[model samples]
Target: MPTPGFPPSTLDSEGTPIWISDLAGGDPNHVLHVVRGIEAEDALEALGAKPGLIRSCELPDSKPDEWTSLPCAALGVEPGGSAALLAGRVGEWTFVYDDSGFTYDDAVTKALSADGRTAATSVYTINGDASLTYAVDGEQVEWVNFDDLELDEGFAGMPAELRAAFEAAGNVETEDFEPGEADGDILMRAACALAGLALTLDDVRRVPLLVVPFG
Candidate 1:
């Protein structure tokens, strides 16, 4: 109906909506990685997380702002040198949400996509810029940025349909967001839509994951 994943998702509990806009409105800094065909533990290990510190937990039943310190402290992590992230398999995609921007690297995004996994990364910066990078089987296909608003470069291998979706995801307009409040979610939506992941806020809330102190 809605092009499979475009438009700000909304649900009584999931989809894109004020929840995402609110996340950006409050912190505007985080990294969300969606990797297709990988388990939660494999996703963490792929990202260089130590196996010992990895702990099983449910997504915090709290707001995102409190996540930075609370989870890391509980995991005995300093919450400074490395980021405490939540990773889990939800359907065909493994979602990793980094409250701290520690995993916000293009190399890391491509690395996850390596060895037969398809991955997409959405990076939201405190300076109000955001980006979505799409990769396949370990190679970077393309990347688009909110600040520059450019879709050119690294798109040669990407299909026309996906490229068009990226265009659509970036150009989404809604009064739901105040100034600069939707960039992160927009990129996130683009990533999910492009990668064919159906996500809900309830899944984010209810999924079982291995929490890790990731550098």
Candidate 2:
């Protein structure tokens, strides 16, 4: 059965599953959008992808790393473009696996939420740093880095329910804590929990997907 607020296989009132942050689990870099009320093409445009470059394809296996090297031709990747992005819909929202794109661009997050859609973005860079953001209707509500764990807005615009639930499952801060795998796990759960997403492993692995240029 589904947890009260979180997805069936996601977090609970107690905590997140141990599997959320592993290489065998969620994509390392992603921006999950609550696009239920919008169309797929519109959602892509909102993320600032080039309109004519979108391609259709299917994932061959369940590897999370495949997102980085989706068939070049099948993904419609241009000769001189930034990294390619893969997108797939899971229920009402669209899950986008981004590679070296706009995960940190405040503008992209603003545009995505401008149309009343919510966005949850998270990333753990190889340099031992991590970032997470939650936006609603063009307003950035949550912005924090694993290095500091200091929320820029202090849960200002989050709904009462999400705020409390996130506070519970999200990790607590330590004085000299540098981010590690555990921090990455927190990001995976936050990307979904903060945006009210309910993603399961089966939803992304080997799913039919849309590929677009990062720019």
Candidate 3:
């Protein structure tokens, strides 16, 4: 059996391979938050990497023809949906046809790299059916994808608050930030924002966004 921190998850019962990213929910010590697929190979390839990709089969089919709403419900960003929603808005991404053929380092590097403007970090597993159990007890780790967050101008300067939340979370400025590339700093900040809401490590599993509840 593969332990935590391993890469490239095995195929589910439906023959679909599960891709997990360490969204880590709120607990810095914890790992793995959301599990989804690597949608949009062109998005990945545009990021610069070998072909072969996976995408989430659970995405909203019809497109809403309007975007003039205050909090656009179309913002429809499922924590466990396909990366296509986020990656499609940004850049290209390719899928991996064979897991054994590629090394974990290579796959991770490709996902983490900013070559194609944006790419997924990698995949992991969520463990048992006791989903909440993962974040409870002594050891808690939730797997989440970085691409799922609706991180645009709506979350530009949210770093200060995010940094205070997660010990492992911080900013990583780089000249590499392209015109349309998603900023990692903003992403990390948003992660923290979401963390503030989580009391126990388990409370933050398969999270949606850095939503801070109003007092």
Number of the predicted model whose TM-score against the real structure is largest: 1
Error of 2 at 5 (Å): 8.2
lDDT tens digits by residue: candidate 2, 72-169: 33454432256556666656666665655344576666677677777666665545466666677888877756655544445565567446545544
Model 2 is weakest, by summed lDDT over 10 consecutive residues, at 17-26
Q: Report every candidate's CA lDDT.
A: 0.64, 0.53, 0.25
Pick by lDDT: which candidate is best? 1
Candidate 1 overall lDDT versus native: 0.64
Tell me the TM-score of each prediction against the true structure: 0.73, 0.64, 0.21
Q: Write the per-residue lDDT of candidate 3 for residues 63-182, one digit (tens) a residue.
A: 233311111113343322212222221112222211111222323333433332222223222231111111111122332334443323433333433323222322232476554443
- Candidate with better TM-score, 2 vs 3: 2
What are the C-alpha RMSDs, in order, of all predicted structures?
4.9, 6.1, 19.2
lDDT of 1 at 200: 54
Better of 1 and 2 by TM-score: 1
